[model samples]
Target: MSTTLSPLIDLQLKGFKVYEKNLTLQEAERPLLAAQIFSRRDYYKVLLLESKCVLHYAHQRLELDGGQYLFFTNPHIPYSLELRTDRLHAYACLFTEEFVAAARSESLHQSPLFRIGSTPLFKLPASQADYVRGIFHKMLAEQQGDYPFKGDLIRTYVQLLIHEALHLQPADPVVQPNNAATRLTSLFLELLERLFPIELPTQQLTLKTPQDFADRLAVHVNHLNKAVKQVTGKPTSAHIAGRILDEAKALLQHTDWSVASIATCLGFEYPTYFNNFFKKHTGVTPLSLRRKD
Candidate 1:
């Protein structure tokens, strides 16, 4: 099965949580684990290694030695790690986008770590590794505590890790753009993905149509549609509708929010409207999906 943040967290901790792990795996288990492919998800994952390894990230294959940091992984990329040593000691931090949604709202998508073609693998010197490891250690320790503001503290640590990575020179230089179509399509998709997870009931998705995205990207609707269709092999409207449908299904299946509240969160004026939209795309009502689960 593909690994997502929630299920992976369940293997280690509890709800919407963040924690660090120091792993020592046997060489015999490496091949079995390496064969697994992890698709991207709406979460941020960072790995700091105490031993050597090879990282497979989308089209880039990187060899990272001890005291190295693998840059942040976001939903737009697919990645995995392979250990080279019998006992690999590494610190990995994983947290969902919703966990840091409020704090990083304006800048998460713009981070260099998520920029396509930017190198994400960085080798940290011993001193720098200690500094970064200190933050991870604190997060791991505090996760075991019952402090009232523990979650906020962990968020702060996550921010620190990102900032620390930013302080270093990027591993690879940015690639030149291909064409207007690809650039526009990338911008459009980034804009679309930015307003996601719908963390709060009052937080609604404001961009609900191709025109909304076009205006945000400062392009004419027809131009945006052509660019998106050419790159994604789907109509612009279909992309918007599909993303909305995905978030709707996730909320219905994962949360206890009522159908009406979900509809409002998804920018539908009414619950009935969301019902029809969901039914049109998926063969079942939101209520039924939730119940079936």
Candidate 2:
């Protein structure tokens, strides 16, 4: 069975939460734990896992042997965790952007450690892991207290955690070929995935065409198109159209936003253009799809 964890709902209920688990009990005494799949969230997460597990994050998969590792994720990326051993011990802190407002230098989502395509996993040395564990213990203890300024104190702890991870060396870069097609294709995909989950109706997609993406990737349009096609077996325009179509369908089905609003947010200059595009690709109008739903 699979489970979808939504931190947005949790953060709406409580701006912040911290928890820990130690699953070292004997097999007969242990409780069943299912793999957790989480979609994009509007909050940030900091996790320390001391277990053997496979982490599927965005477009990358990481197999972590039994050891302490610090992981950071922001609102844009989705990830899942599958435990490989019964000796799972972990601590996690989840908080909305407002929870750390006082401590942030800029949007946490834009930070290098949490930004898309940047490495967020760091293997911790024993000494650093012990220090990190102590910080989590403090967070847990203070979370139960009645101090009026505890919220401020907790924010400091969260900032400290970010600082600690920033000081540590990140894991070796995932090995990929130096070939231009492979590298360009990987960068193109990451750039494409970054502009997603359009959480607010006021938010608008800035890069809407293959040329737009190619410009941002700093290669000629033809170069990007050729490389993407060579590596992914599809033209760049096809991929862009496919992603936009997926997001359009998702918004039409899951959201109450009007067609005009959806069109504007999706970078369409006019609703008529959006209507034609959607119908041409899906053989149904956006409104029809919503009404059918």
Candidate 3:
């Protein structure tokens, strides 16, 4: 069954305050939030559960029965839960992308930490659970203090947890090396798709080039370009231009915004630039496209 998790605002109102920086750790409490459909939050989520439950993420589901376990959810994926046990005792820790920025790691989408489109649940043995619980306790204890380095310490603890997870089930280096190229390409396309539909007349895409995405993914431009071409049979820049042109056509046809306004929204420095770009890509100018529409 689909369930809607609480929003960040609702969670904050219910005592999930930011303990330090962009991180917040919330203990399960009374009058539990209702289970609905999928819930999307703009931060990373880690839940250490003490009860059995079924979690639905994207097209897949995981059934956990008793024992301590760790489940991870990144900002990109929306998930829901169905509590199999009446008593739901869990500790949820949330942190934004910027909070853990200092740690140089793979993009969550391509990282083995959570895997894509699925909620990763790692069953903790009794001994391991005790150790993991201690980490959570330390975070909780640190919450009571005003130490300036509190955020840094918590980020380190989170990193510890990630390392532990990796240790438990390390990715196969041999297989991954072969698959990494395709995976990176796919992840890039997914990231590109996220900034779409131009919901408003003012929404501008910050990632306008292959280099921007390469920087974000922590990969060199050549590697990213090669992977994209190998997988999609097109150059990296072509995909970007195609998407921008698609967005431009959609905007011109649907919105009454002027050409200049549309140009700015599509990341063009000037209307003349957008006009030339549109013409180069579509054999017609933005105004011409709008007239046809």
Query: Highest TM-score, which number?
Result: 2
Clash statistics: count for each candidate: 0, 0, 4
User: Which candidate, 2 or 3, would have the higher lDDT against the true structure?
Assistant: 2
- Please, what are the lDDT tens digits per residue for candidate 3 over residues 1-293? 22343343221211121221111123222112322221224456776777777766543467878778887777555455667755666666676666677774666556566555233778999998888878877777655454546677777778877777777774652233258877897688767767665767778888999999999999999999999899768899987887777677656655678999988888999999999988987788788767755
Worst-scoring 10-residue span by lDDT in model 1: 31-40
The lDDT of model 1 is 0.70
* Model 2 per-residue lDDT tens digits across residues 1-293: 22443444331224777778776645312222211232234567888988888886765679999799999987666565667876678888888888788788798766777877766998999999999999899989777665556788889999988989887753543446579799999889888887887888999999988889988988899999999899878899887777777678767765789999999998999999999999999899999888875
Candidate 2: C-alpha lDDT: 0.78
Please report, as a residue range, the 10-residue window in candidate 3 with the lowest summed lDDT: 15-24
Give candidate 2 misplaced runs (Cα > 4 Å). Answer: 1-14, 22-40, 170-187, 198-222, 225-293
Using lDDT as the measure, which candidate wins? 2
Candidate 3, after superposition: displacement of residue 150 in Å? 1.0
List the candidate 3 regions with Cα displacement exceeding 4 Å.
1-40, 105-110, 115-119, 173-293
C-alpha lDDT (0 to 100) for residue 71 of candidate 1: 63
Q: List the residue pairs that clash in candidate 2.
A: none
Over 13-105, each residue of candidate 1 has an lDDT whose tens digit, in order, gives 332344444456644333222212221244567767667777766444688765567467665554556778766666666666667775686
Residue 198 C-alpha lDDT in model 3: 71
